[model samples]
Target: MKKLVTLVLFLFILTSTNVVAFANSTPKIPVLLYHVVTQNPSGTYQFSLTDFKNDMAYLKKNGYTPLSLNQYYNILNGTVTAPSRPVLLTFDDSTSDFYTNVYPVLKQYNFKATQFAVTDWLDTNGHLTRAQLQMLSANGIDIANHTIKHQPLTSDWNTQYSAINNANIKLKSITNNAANSVAYPYGNYNSTTMSVLKNLGCQGGFTVSGGLSSSNSNKYELPRIIMANGDSVSVFARKLTTGY
Candidate 1:
C-alpha cells in the first residue's frame, strides 16, 4: 500500500508539471510551402487552381492570417508581432502559372503569398516575365530570391554565390525593393554557405527540412515542410492542422 501511494503521488506531480509546461508554451504557426499552381495538371509538384482556392477558403473561414515572406522574417527576428493564428504561404520558382493561376485566387480571397523566383529561369520554362514580377509586387505578392540558376549552395560555393547575387540584382531591377530572403536550391546548405548568406544581408534562408519555427531556431537557416504535388483537399486540410 505504501509503495502504491508513493508511485501515485509521483505520477500526479509529473502530470501537473507537464500541464504547466504546455499551458505556458507558445503555439507554432504552420508555413505551407508550394511550388507550382497549375490547371489540373498531373504531377507531384502541381496543385490545381481549384484546390488552391479551396485551401485559401479554408484559411479564410478558419480565421487564419496569411503572412508574406517579410512578415515571416519579422517574426523570426522578433521585429513584428505574431497573430494568434498565423500562416506563411510560400510558392517556389517564379513560374508564370503563379501569376495566371495562383495570383488570381490569392487576390480573390485577399490573401498574400511569397514567391521565390529563379532569376535565370524567369523568361524560360514558362516562368514569370519581368513585367509580371513588378505587377505581382504592386498587387501585394512578395518576390524573394531562389538563386540565379537554382543550384545547390553546398555543392559549388563560387557558382552558388554568383547565382544568388545575380538573382538579387534581377529581383531588385524588377520590384525596385530590397530582396533579403532566399530558399536554398535542392534544400542544400552548409555552414560555409550559411556564412556567405549571412554576409549577403539575408535575414533568413529556408531549407527542405521539416519543423516549426521558434525563437531558438536560426533565423538564417530555417526548415520548411514539403507539400507534395497534387495533394487532395482533405490531405491538404490535414496538413494545415497537423503541421506536416
Candidate 2:
C-alpha cells in the first residue's frame, strides 16, 4: 500500500510539471499595426519605407515569424499552435503605398501580413484599387474589414451593422474572400461591437490598444501596438520584446 501511494504521488507531480511547462510555452504574440509605408512623413501614423524595411529585417534576424489574421484566429481557437516568436503585422487603410512600397518588402522577406481595408475608399485618390486587393488576396495576404467609410463602430447599432456589412460585402465582391476579421477604425468600438461582429461571422477583431496578444485574449478586443514614424530599431525591438 505504501509503495502504491508513493508511485501515485510521483505520477501526479510529473503530470503537474508537464502541464506547467505547456502553459509556459504558450506564445505571446505582438500584433504590430501600421497605416502607410512611405518616404514622406505624411502623418504620425505613416512610417517611412526605410524604417519599415529595417523593422522587417530586424524581425527576420531576430527570429520573429509573421502570421496572418487567419492563422492568429486559429491559434486563439486552439485549432493550431503558434510558431516560434510569432507576430501579426497589420496594415490599415489599404493605402496605395501598400502596393507600391509595402508589398515588395513583404515579398522580399517572404512574410505575410493582414490589411484592414476601408472598402468605400478603395481606388479613390490614394487608396488601393480592386485589382490590387484581388492580387493581394491571391498572394496570401489576408484582407480584413476596416468598415465601409472608416466609421467608428461605437455609434448606433444600425449604423455599425451597415458599415461592417457593407464593407464585408464589397471586400468579398472584390477579393472573393470574406472579411472574417476586422480592425476597428481609430480603434474605437463599444460593448455591442463584439456581438455585432459575431453576428456577422467575424471570428476576431483588433484594437489600437498596445499589448502582447495571447491565445487566452478576448477575441474581439485584441490589442495591437501601432508602429509610428521615426521609431528607431531599438524602439521597434522593444515593442516586439515588451509590447510597449
Candidate 3:
C-alpha cells in the first residue's frame, strides 16, 4: 500500500492540474457516485449499462485505476498520494443489477469498486441477497454502509446514529466486516451525524456534493460526483478530470 501510494504521489506531482478543483495541498481523488446500472433505466440516478461499460472502458483506455475504499483510505490517510489518474468507483444501493450486470464488467477490467448498501434492504426483492453480498465482499468489492433502511439522516442525533449503527452491525454480520465508511442516505448529513460516526470509529463519511476529496478534506464529509443516466461518456470523463 505504501509503494502504491508513493507511485501515486510521484504521478500526482507530474500531472498536477492547478486549474482543476481546490489548490493542490494534497492529492485529490475523484470519488464517483453511481446508483443502479440497468438495461432499461429511469430516474436521475439510473445509468444505462451500455454507458456504464463505455465509462469503464474509457477509464481503462485512458489509464485510470479504480481503488476500493480500504485502498483509498490507506492512500489518503497515509501519504496523500494517488496514481496519475486514480479514481474511486462508488455505487450507492446494492441493487441486484449490480451483481447481475455491473460486477462482471468491473472484473473484466480488473477494477476495484465500493458498494454502499442499505443494510435492511439486503435480501429484499430487488436488492442483493446476503449470500451475494458475501460473494462480492470476498471477490475484491468493498462492501460499505449506506444506512440501516435508507432513512433520511437529519439533525436528530438518535435517528442518525441508529441508522448508521444498526447498518454497520448488519453489514458486519453479512459481509464478515464492519463498514470502514458510510455514505449518508440521499447524501444528507450534519455535525451530529459526523459526531455519531466519530464515536462509532467510522473512517469516512461520504456526502453527495463536493467535487473531489483529499487529505485536506473533512473525513466525515467527503464528496462524490453523482453520475446520472443522462450523462454521456464525455461528461463522465470531464467529471473525473475537471470535476464540473
Candidate 4:
C-alpha cells in the first residue's frame, strides 16, 4: 500500500508539471519601447541607427510580427485573432530621426508600429514635421498622442486632462486617424491621471515601468522596457526572449 501511494504521488507530480508546461507553451507577447530613434546626442534619449536596423533584422529573422496597439488590445480583449508571435514596436517623441533612420527598416520588414507624438512639438528643429507624420500614417503606421506639450500628466487635473484631450484632437485633425493611445511623458502618472485618460476615451497608455504586459494587467497603465544606447544585438535578442 505504501509503494502504491508513492507511485500515485509521483504520477500526480508528473501530470502537474505537464499541465504547467502546456500552459506556458502559449506564445507570450512583447511590447518594446523606443525613444528618439536617431544618432546618439550625448545626453538625449537616442538609439544608434545601426542598432535599430540590427534589432529590426533580428525581429524579422526570428519571425516576429509587430502589431499596433489597437490590434494588441483587441488580442488581449479577445476581439481579434492574436498573432503567433505578437510584438509591439513603439517609438515616442516623433523625432525626424524616425523618418530618416527608422522608417526604412520598418518598411523593409513590412511591420506595423506605434508612434506617439507631441502635437505642439511638430515641425520644430529635431522633431518630425506635420507632413512627415501624415506620410507615416499613409504608410500604415499607427500614430497616438504623447500630449501637446509633453508635460507629465500628473501635474494637475485641468492641465493634465486637457493636455491629453487636446493632443488627441489635434493628432486626429492632422493625420485623420483616431489617436487612441497615450504614453506618459517621462513615464509619470498618478491615479488621477489614469482617471483622466479613461474619461478621455484612451484605449491604452504606456509607462516606463519595465516589464511584460498581460491580459490581467491594467490596460491604461501598461509598463514597457526601454531600448537605448549600450543595448547590443544580443541584449535585444535576450529582451525578446524574456518578453520585456
TM-score for each model: 0.84, 0.89, 0.87, 0.86
> Model 3 shows how many backbone clashes?
1
**What's the TM for model 2?**
0.89
Candidate with best lDDT: 2
Q: Give a tens-digit lDDT track for model 3, residues 183-210.
A: 9888888889899999999999999994
Ranking the candidates on lDDT from highest down gives 2, 3, 4, 1
Please report, as a residue range, the 10-residue window in candidate 4 with the lowest summed lDDT: 19-28
Candidate 3: list runs displaced more than 4 Å: 1-25
Candidate 4: residue 30 Cα off by (Å): 1.4
- Compared with the true structure, model 4 gives a TM-score of 0.86
Cα displacement (angstroms), candidate 1, residue 173, comes to 1.5
lDDT of 3: 0.87
lDDT of model 2, residue 189: 96
- List the lowest-lDDT window of 10 residues for candidate 2: 18-27
Q: State residue 83's C-alpha deviation in candidate 3, in Å.
A: 2.6
Q: Compose the digit string of candidate 2's lDDT tens values, residues 1-244.
A: 9999999999999987865655566688899999888888777888999999999999999898899877877666555777878899999999999999999999999999999999989989999999999999999799999999998889888899899989999999998989888899999998888888989889888999999987678989999999998999999999988889
lDDT per residue (tens digit) for residues 1-244 in model 4? 9999999999999987865554344345678988876656444457777788889988888888899777888766655666767889999998888888888889989999988999999999999999999999989799998999999877778988889999999999889988998999999989888888889888888998877776656988787778867689998987876855
Query: Cα lDDT of all candidates, in order?
Result: 0.80, 0.89, 0.87, 0.84
